[model samples]
Target chain A: MSFLGGVDTSNGVVLDPECSLIGESVRGRILCFPFGIGSTVGSYAMYQLKLNKVAPRAIINRSAEAIVATGAIMSEIPMVDNVDTSLIKSGDRVVVDAANGTVEIRDVTERHVVTSILRNRGRVLILKRSDKVGSYRGSWAGVSGFVEKDEGDEEAARREIVEETRFTNARLSRRVPARGFRHNDSVWTVHPFLFDVSSRDVSIDWEHEAYAWILPGELKDYTTVPGLGAVMNDLLSRTSP
Target chain B: MHLTKDEEHVLAGEEGAARQKAMELLVSLGDIYGAERLIPVKSAQVSGASFKTIGDAGIQWLEDMSEGTRASVPSMVNPLGLDMRRWRSMGVSPDFHGKQARIVAAYRSMGLLPVYSCTPYLAGYRPRRGQHLAWAESSATVFANSYIGARTNREGGPSALASAIIGKSPEYGLHLDENRLPKVEVNLPSVPEGLVPLAGYTAGKVAGNRIPLISGQAFAEDEHKSFGAAMAATGAVSMYVSKGTVGHVRSRGIDRSMIEERVTISSRDLRRCAEELSGDDEWDLVAIGCPHSSTRELAHMARKLKNRRPRRNCDVWFCTSRMVHSRCPQHIATLRRFGKVLCDTCMVVAPIEEMYARTATNSGKAMVYLPTLGRQTASFRTTDQLLEAISR
Candidate 1:
């Protein structure tokens, strides 16, 4: 048997008509597919699962969303990411070893290559984004986007920086391996490569309105992704040579 | 920052396991922020509940890892009120119980007051800006650092409690009064006329993440609660909720109809402002009791519901202090029949997943709305108006 655990990491409520069935079927089941979506307030619901002692024993994710990951980490639930959710189904018994960050399905069909990006920052080559992309369309961001078929994840990230920001001569740092998660058809990878751009190399893409060389303290002006901000904060704190 | 001799000793394993663990965590955090020396803190307001209760092991690990050193700061805590009897009946796992007991034991041993609500300000732990406090209320943090001008980082539960125990937090961000300066400023046209709660919500939307020094309104103290609740609701991270009332309006016999009309427009403007300020959905949780609902408000809820009947499937909880709860147990059945009357805890303070309300509405216009604090983001409106929404 295979199971698809419908986990929501929102701080708000995800009201579904078939909530009871999903809740029961998914418990102790192979948590499957996609990063939990919906309201950030759903974070509280995740908390409630622990309070009532009915939380999913383990989580299988395309990628860990910020609130969910933070909440799960804070709550200490086992979770594993980067595994294809398609192999798991509506009813499957599974044991999730979150401490080691792995998952074992009772009867799995196939496996896919799952990579996670460990992003580090020195001078995050920020791109002044334009309105072409939806969401934060005309804002600043680090090298970000999805890894297309055949193209390497690193190439895609660097290409995205160039395509979005029009930077060409900056040196590419080591590729921080990461995964891409599609929560409800939105597929983006977890890996972001770090690069150091010279003063002359810094330029704004039509995608972004402007760019800045900001320290961790100054990065607050531009709203980067939530967990990413915390990550950058950690990097900023590390002792440098 | 230099660790106190006591803190240093803890770091070196002079103290027992709990203190060692807690201090080690603090030192790492301090090193990250470049805090040279640790300072003492008077009080701390902590957030986050037990791993057992929250059911997420990741959260549990984070809690345990951060709780390494039992810092010696006076602290205020959010309620993790677990009815163990109820859990046993549900056949809850023992692992969950053990994790929760560890946290509870830690707090109790530290002499931390486990009030368990996010709105410590209501519980009388208001730390004015620059007051040398260690707090973990997200909305309260925003309110204190931005509005009240208190200093704090968005420190998580363990560090926040530790700082309160040791009486010091890293002097960064809001701690440096200069960082608390208002980057964005908003001005209101006039006081709300009708359903002041709606007007307060409007103010929250307009003031998101910006410092709003309000003008042009006169409100009773109860009304101020409404405004604060609404501001926090609409996502104004911080606010200087001052009296904008002009004496002439009341003295000259201001027409009630005119005031109501302005209040309506103000509420709409608030929604518009919130949309403009926020990036994502701009959605948040609507919470009441920033300072906790005043005793008079609780009394009013009890009296009103005293003669009324409960709406089917509608949960109207009245959160207040224990002092207020003791005054009206006889009305408990009536209140529960309609809604829950929770004491020493409010929706924003305690985890309300069981309440099953994704979005909550309240009445007021000061700075009560804090979606993040509620653990569920929110939308704000006045109490009477919200009652209509909930009923519908």
Candidate 2:
């Protein structure tokens, strides 16, 4: 959002070397990004884009920050936020209904998966996936598996915990709605769960190689799955009391 | 969100195109922040007035928006990149001045007052207690909300302009009484001479987005200007309440039980901040008045320098609003011996990087921007220290 350095208003290209969309032209295209960063004057940069006839046709963001929102309104550009921006691609045609605050991506599919966390006392269990697993092999993750068709999220969570950790006596403490993440072409809608167990002991199966009981603060030290720490924090903190 | 019939008509594009666009901006922002309705504001202070900051694209947008738009309330503009009368002497090229003049013309055509100062409250547009405003300049918004006992969210430039055109803003954030209550208590030991801005800078980092209740020091109105300017520069919150009699809080129905964080800023901490902010002493430019100098500040500097002779070794600028500049002509004449008494511009938004490599300023807000926006190696000094350095 550096109006002075990051954008070339005349050509509608992102000139910022640090920007992910460097050299990309926003002209007549629906621009989708997480949110704007940098100066408040970045709002003016957006207006500049419109003046040059290089402004984005529409804007979609994960969340609406004030700067970009102000810019879009001032420039008369249609915009919507609180959308899963990862489901959008560069060439994907986006229809932004700012009045309803929704964005629809023309061609993309969403897949749902259940990721369950097993907690014993104060520590949560982290399992390393086996190489024989479908995706993210050798990566540390929560007890996870794809949701079977027609299965409830909680029922799927219980099944995954029993199959991955062999903990049949685990009680479901908390369950949160699914969150989406973009991986290659498919959108992973991870339904998170926190289960309390009586013991730290676990029986590993063919899907996992090793397991460890680590404090939640130490989740950053290990290379786990995407959004694992966030999912764990949300589930654990909500059910703490 | 609920909209009245008139508001709905404007949103539905029943009104003229400009007013409809303004209504749409307000309505969408209201939706984003979950504001229940739009409230009328007494005034607005719009930023992004400078050509150096906004550039060619800004000129184009302003020209387009100016076609049919006019301010519904009393609105003032922020500082431009150069003094309108003295651009030739300030080292601003003709090309930049031409672009800047177009911006000024556009704003003037839109019915904005030509008080190109960040301290619009000081320059005749002061709002009363309990009045709501849609001010954009961070320093002015903080001053209006905290010191003047007004209500306003820190608005962006275009939103504030929209508010000016329609005379209404989204009722959210600081406009709500519940959000005005102090969530953190900041205790300060006696702030050293010329370190008040640093204390504010430190307080901002400690408070983050929470409204801080400051205790243990009495500050004058001018000190509040510098302190609050620095606080808003570093922190996300627009208002802070001091414990002293000055700028007292009207905590009518607020619950004080939510305060969980208490921070103490000691003399050692201030010293550390000063040491960390102090850069090289040798500077090509020594500029002051980041929030724009008040009349009293101009007179004080004039009194101090009236007896001393100018060294004239390096460039010096005494930045202030034209209104204040007009009020202190004798002071301006005396200070002009030392350096240029610049108006409608300060070191932060000016194109100082193209002219000077190193700069020194006393303002904590300037210390944050001079390095990044001005692209100069910055040196932090007190006003007295900077004045003494630039004088014989």
lDDT tens digits by residue: candidate 2, B63-148: 87788889999999999999999989999999988889999999999999998999988787888988989998999988888888
Query: Which docking band does candidate 2 fall into?
Result: medium
For model 2, residues A115-233, the per-residue Cα lDDT tens digits are: 98888889999999999989999889999988899998888989988888889999988888778887777778999988999998899999999999999999999899899988987
Docking class of 1: incorrect
Off by more than 4 A, model 1: A1-241, B2-6, B31-36, B50-71, B81-106, B124-130, B142-154, B191-209, B218-291, B303-313, B327-338, B348-360, B363-381, B386-392
lDDT of all the models against the reference? 0.51, 0.86
Locate the minimum summed-lDDT window of 10 residues in model 2 chain B.
B245-254
Across A1-241, the per-residue lDDT of candidate 1 in tens digits comes to: 1111234333222234444343333343344556655333344455545655656667777665444554454334666776766545556656677657677665543311222122225345444546676655655556566567788765775677566556665565444334333322333436644555554444555556766655556667776542455445433444531
Q: What is the fnat of candidate 2?
A: 0.81
**Alpha-carbon shift of residue B47 in model 2 (angstroms):** 0.7
- Find the candidate with the highest TM-score and give its number: 2
> Per-residue CA lDDT of candidate 1, range B1-392, in tens?
67667677876767665555556556545654557766666678776554423335325433454454443555776544332333342233566556666666666655677565555666666665356677765555545554454556656665675565556666655455334433333445654343555555665666666545455555665665555555655653543434432211122432233121122244457555444423232222333444455566665655655665544444455555554455556654545555545554455434444433355545432224234444444544445544443332
Query: Model 2: how large is the Cα RMSD against the reference?
Result: 3.6
Tell me model 2's lDDT, rounded to 2 decimals.
0.86
Clashes of each: 111, 0
Looking at model 2, how many pairs of residues clash? 0
Number of residue pairs clashing in candidate 1, backbone atoms closer than 3 angstroms, sequence gap of 3 or more or interchain: 111
Each prediction's RMSD over C-alphas, in Å, is: 15.1, 3.6
